[model samples]
Target: MLSKYPGAVFRGALSGAARRAIPASFLSLRIALPLAMAFSLGLSLAVHQEACAQTDDEQTVKAIFDERLTSGEMYYLLEDLCKNIGPRLSGSEGAERAVTWAKEVMEGYGFDRVYLQEVMVPHWERGNPEQVRIVDVEGGMIALNALAIGGSVPTAPAGITAPVVVVHSIEEVEELGREAVEGKIVFYNRAFDQTVIGTGAGYGGAVTQRFAGPSQAAKFGAVGVVIRSVASNFDDAPHTGGLSYLEDVERIPAAALGFQSADRLVEVLEVQPDARLYMHLSSKWHPDALSHNVIGEIRGSERPDEIILVGGHLDSWDVAEGAHDDGAGTVHSIGVLRTFQKLGIRPRHTIRAVLFMNEENGLRGGLKYAEAAKESGEKHLIALESDAGGFSPRGFGASVDDDVLERFRSWLPLFPQNTISYVNKGGGGADIGPLRRETGTPTIGYIPDSQRAFDYHHAPTDVFETVNRRELELGGASIATLIYLIDKYGLRDEKAQ
Candidate 1:
């Protein structure tokens, strides 16, 4: 399937009348004066043309925004992914269905090419509902809403019951030593730092306890680990995310308690001094299974060999629909291609959209794509990712050299002041990080408003209803406009010339 190619450029012609031959003495003076005037006139015309091009860029950006805001299709696409297919953890039936669905949807849009790249992905399942409770509280027994961390080992059939030892950080567990932690449950009670302006920074600051706490506690001979939910709001829903276990340390079960439940546990521990808790998880690890990264593109009219990639992970946690975590990003990437094709805006560089698999539990898809690019000797112009929730646009965070960053900053005027106002340094997506490292492709992370991102990140509440249609469309429009600019004007340092 292909859209009619619109590969035409219009040029303005300037013609002048020829003059009769002159005498040798007068020829030198007449020729010099005309030549000097011609040079000045040429410079003025060049400046005027540059200004006209800049104005066209602004008008084009506005058109893209208008189309997306008024007649966007990403919202419906996200609905199908989040509602019909639901959670798509790698190696599961849902993940496979998502692969096929994405392929067909892109094909329907009539991209020039559509295909899949095979990748073996890690497979793990949350087998059953987790059972965690504060057994020794004054009230009969308080059940704490919790979820087993992805990639964690299952607890004993009968479950674990022991005295709870509270620690704010992994270092605190080290301070307590094996003597205090052995045969006990380590509760990592650190909460999100509300003082941080960016919620993402707060998540980064607190996520270490969830990602490394289990292994660190296990190193000190703890039987189990429990952590406060890495969430922005105080609610009954528990957030689930992947955990990394060191090879040398003993594998132990880990879970995250809802913010309110965590606070309840703290209150009990404060009064009782030595409160016992019970935790039972039914999570299991399966053999790595086959998956694929769905890819589609509208080949560049001029520079087909050089590619500009836009992508997001397709696999989400199995807890609930992954609307914000990445469903927004997946649709955003596809929307870029759809908008370009619908408007007949053939890019100058091959613009490819990738729906990477296995970002939730593992980065297999991203690594595979990068490896393939290197083997084929592919040249990537840039890679952009949208993993943040589908919120109103803010700007982008870039992982590029200062010259490239400056070049990107110059294009900010094309975008509206309310949308995409800044382009900061130091940001890239988990899936695209390998590509940047393997191929040296400059990376950009689409930054939406961070206020409500953590609220649904990795939680059951991250469903389709939480996403606002206008917000999601605006995010996609912002990405499309950026890609259009990058394709139109290459990322070279023009000032050097």
Candidate 2:
């Protein structure tokens, strides 16, 4: 069990000096001249003191990086987690092992406290291989690479055999109405927008179809849905992600086709407008199963009641080893705590690392954590999440008010020349988002390079070997440095004015 208390407010230290009323009367020529010179000297001393303090902060940041680069354990820990535990889908045996392993590792690191918070999560298994084939095409049957979307309902024993209706957007499905879409398998061919500079932007632009297409098509009496993989790379690797079913509508089977497969589908449809598809999916959802959010903490020297959270989801999609999807992020969170202990940096606020469960298909872990925080009245100053893949560090994305954004921007110079140089406006992470929405706590997301993330995202190719050691360690150090700054200065809203 965990104990929670009321939120704590921090007050800034005040200067003891008071102004005297005799200043105006002492304006005589001789007296005023020496007074002015003394005041100028005092101003010079103050400026010098400020400069010295900045140098000390810079030195501390440098030390954090030095410790991370030379003797970092994140990469090794990641290797063990990936090779040993493998895929940790929530409620599965792998997920249970991961929970135990994470807690044990934190305790071994000698954190002040280590514990687990109970969470009930959805358990969905991708049972057997899926099948998708073009039945009535001109050149006969053609098999397409595919993976069932998480939480999708399984097709009947005979499977679904229906004519295909192609639509680019959900709006098109609506415009077609039930007459054209009924009893047909809707094919969503919206590809990733390559023109977007940020690959993440391209993903955001195209992912809506994968997440909402199934239910939207079901609304129009569609039998099944197949969406182009929400990926940038033009390859045969099919990307899988979670999808939600509308409670009021019928749940239909949904799957993603790789870029090449999607292109082939278009070619057939152009030649034979009456082409039909045969889809078989064995994915199913089980009853809610017990899980836990693995938590570890280093108590603050002064404000132990105040908390600064660093974390990533421990559970990932079951397809691959989840190395880049979140294995790197899990180790990155642990590395932040390890850095604090190794460097002997006792922060002013408690630093807690949370390995959230069930972020891939369901957000049960995140929802539970936020609920407990609300009920217990815990005061969280900020929550930082590293869900983005472990690529070269770009910067951070912050979900905070304008004033807080400016304050974070002021510390941009503390980072290395090209690594983590900016803080843009965005949601921190799926697990931490509820905490931000419930409380006013500021949230931050570590934004690594997005160019190659989709190539390995939720595919079989995402393995431990793909992650770079230096890049992973750098991400950890970046997170630690940001945490150090937050712990020292506090957030703009919480700090003394």
Candidate 3:
């Protein structure tokens, strides 16, 4: 075996002066043997120490899982949030209640501190269930399952009936021009590409229609806008998300048709080219309302100034319990804190858990927190977010330097293969995006298997029971482990410094 010397200089080569001083016979195996033995001994000692450290880390991670699986409260916490609080859209009574509940729960856990940061959030209400139907159809008026996109302006009090025009994308809508789309209800029919391995990518690819379809339609003088649900599965449940109305154009009513409803509409439109849709949306927008981001933390024994953050959005859509959308993530953050306290694992860096508000309609809470964090002048080691649904752990997506990302990948052996197997590049959730941008701090997103996540996302079917107890607890455990590892070690890349 080759010896690794301190200055990266090997043993075989010798200076000309030294070579002459030492006898040629003495410079042979007789002298080389002792040096080789010394190097071997030193290497063995270093290997032994490294092995011991790894074993300790492995044991700690295993304990975290065991504690969560055997006696975790994440599931029950989720139940209370979903069943008791129901929906918690920003600026709603439910959101207020959730902020209070989150603060109290963390306080009850005996955290070092529990507090709230005020933020002004957008307030939009779906005053009544949307009414969307096809007029003069073969089977009379055919009602389609739909929900108003959050922040959408209401239609006329009596509603508007106009001929329907179908378009697959924003470019397509532009191609049709005003003449083809004027006084019509524009339908954006873009489906999720199931062939994509990451379901979130599919949702990402299709969600553009929902977010911008309204303004694009309004640009063409369309009376209203409808879009195929950006969902992975075909179902009657209609998903709802926020829409943006460009200031340059008029605001128009926008809603999402359930996957099944969109399919039915498409079939009917094929047979009856001049079909018209009557859409009535009573969704109202109020002035910005007061809200807060909930925070709790455990002070570090060492490095108290450097902070490590773990969080999820506290708000959800108004249509359902909002369990999988983010209720699962909320409990996961709390559960991590509870685990550390219960296990008596005092961290090296301050660990803070934040429940961000206004993730559904706006990111006021996230932006507020990032601004506050900057004002406070605290050093943030990293921020981790779990907004993906509670499912079996897949891995983490980290937005960090390439070298730091590789360093993270090196730690994967410490995790269970099934739970957390990879750490890919380029990911930090919406709520944590501002933090990464504001401070240049590394951000991580806890990724759970999302094959079924879109099934309940923003839909009424996203309730507490849809989450599995084992899967939810396991997710918490996985997050706790990652935080522990980062705290024990650190993010200071030696090469960068």
Candidate 4:
């Protein structure tokens, strides 16, 4: 059995003069600055770098990255998907069409196998356009731009016209008490902090309101909820994401305000006390509809029994082409698999690229994949999820045994040439989290330079136009390299190969 250690250590290797030695390409305007910053991050993990034999594995991975950077196919593939089949929200005709598109793609690329796993997903349609009318104290009604947040129930007949109660933080609502919250429209004005170099950090700070504000505010007898769009850009587009209601909490109408509208509303409220608003939404959840998880594979020659899975959700919010949010992720996952075949590199374990369904509104796709893995008693040696926006490769974050983690750390030296430094202990993407739990697999999430992801995340602007070509290919190469390494030398010695 492979030794699995619990103690964690980080080994960050860098010389004092690391800066000057890096080449001009390493000093890319798009990549170098982030790499230099990543270099300073002290990692105390210990690893036997000497033990990482200058093996064929290292050579193959380097070649993979080179190909990805120079001649990667993800660029053109994404063009067709985004320009052709844009905005594939799950259970919608677009999502269903995407499944067929993926199947044809796999076959056209000459994959050994291509298939789909049936997934029944919730279909929540955003009906007619939502209306937000600002009733001024001077008696003039101004219509504000808005959209119903995904998974939110539309307002009733004649809609809700209540005094808008704006709060900067959830704690502010608590401070104001139930007396102030009752029968009012709750507007969560928390914006994504842009100062953080890694925008994911900022998103981490403010996403709570978008995900849970409604149920929490409903507890205070709020009539409706309007969360500031979870975005870093200043625009008039309302972003949408998943929302859940706590058991027994009253379900009220919810929506998101564009950053500009949120700011304007704040300004108007300062001058005109007792600002009122009428919100009219017509969104609802219907019965489950058909969806599928698109699966394609490259069978191994040596140890076919072991499995390495790579994936991205095939669903997006129903606005712009879901390119960056996950369409880029899905294409990159497929791009990794396709690159292996194109490069003529056969693996030692079965490598699968799964395009998961319903990741936007529900986690049903992830849950089902894990459930099948558990019930079938199949061993998931390693699983990689690329739900993060397709940006330049930063490093890999993982949830694995300490010994396995130590082994992963040993491989960092190979990726330094590509400037991917961080390889820390972490969880996989939401779509693969359940699989990690059910199978106890060594799960990994692709970490790109999260510098610009939040600006477009879950928003209409999260389209192909926002996706950087070089960055997308870089991300694909990183994932392909990780997949190659894990598949070749198995994640653990104890796993049957």
Best by lDDT: 1
Error of 2 at 354 (Å): 0.9
RMSD of each: 5.4, 5.2, 4.5, 11.6
Which stretches of model 4 miss by more than 4 angstroms? 1-58, 416-418, 493-497
lDDT (C-alpha) at residue 230 in model 4: 84
1-497 in candidate 3: lDDT tens per residue? 11211112122223332344555566477777875566566556555655566667778999999999988588999999999999999999999999999999999989999999999999999998899998755547999999998899999999989899999998898999999999999999988999998999899999999999999988988999999999999888999999988999999999999999999999989999888898999988889999999999999998888899999999999998989889988999988889999989999889999999999999999999888878887788899999999999989999988867876777787777699999989888899899888888789999999999999999999999899999999999999998988887676532454
Cα lDDT tens digits, model 4, 1-497, are 01222111221243334445567776777886677566544221123332243435566777887787787478778878887888888778888888899889998998888999988999998888889878899778877767787888889978988998888777787888899999999999988888877777788798888778888788888999998888877888788787888889899999888888888888888898698988999887889998899999988787676778899988888876888879888888898788899789888788889999998889889989999989998776788999888888888889988867877776676673655787889868999989878878778988988777777777777778787888898788888877876765566554442
Residue 249 Cα positional deviation in candidate 2, in Å, after optimal superposition: 1.7
lDDT of 1 at 312: 94
Model 1 agreement with the true structure over 219-305: per-residue lDDT tens digits: 988999999999899887999999999998899999999999999999999999677899999998889999999999999998999
After aligning candidate 3 to the native by TM-score, how far in Å is the CA of 11 from where it should be?
A: 19
Sorted on lDDT, best first, the list reads 1, 3, 2, 4
lDDT of each candidate versus the true structure: 0.89, 0.87, 0.88, 0.80
Clashing pairs in 1: none
Q: Candidate 3 — worst ten consecutive residues by lDDT sum?
A: 1-10
Candidate 1 deviant stretches above 4 angstroms: 1-48, 137-139, 493-497
Candidate 2 lDDT by residue in tens digits, 1-497? 00000011111111112124236888799788887776666555654555555666788889888887888588889888888999889989999999999999999999999999999999998888999999875547899999998889999977888999999998999999999999999999998898987888888888888899999999999999999999889889899999888889999999999899999999989989899999999887789999999999999998999999999999978888899889988988988889989988998899999999999988888888998998889999899999888888989999888877877788888798878888998659999988887776779999998888988888877889999988988888899999998888777535353
Find the 10 residues in a row with the least total lDDT in model 1: 1-10
Instruction: Give the clashing residue pairs of candidate 2, or none.
Output: none
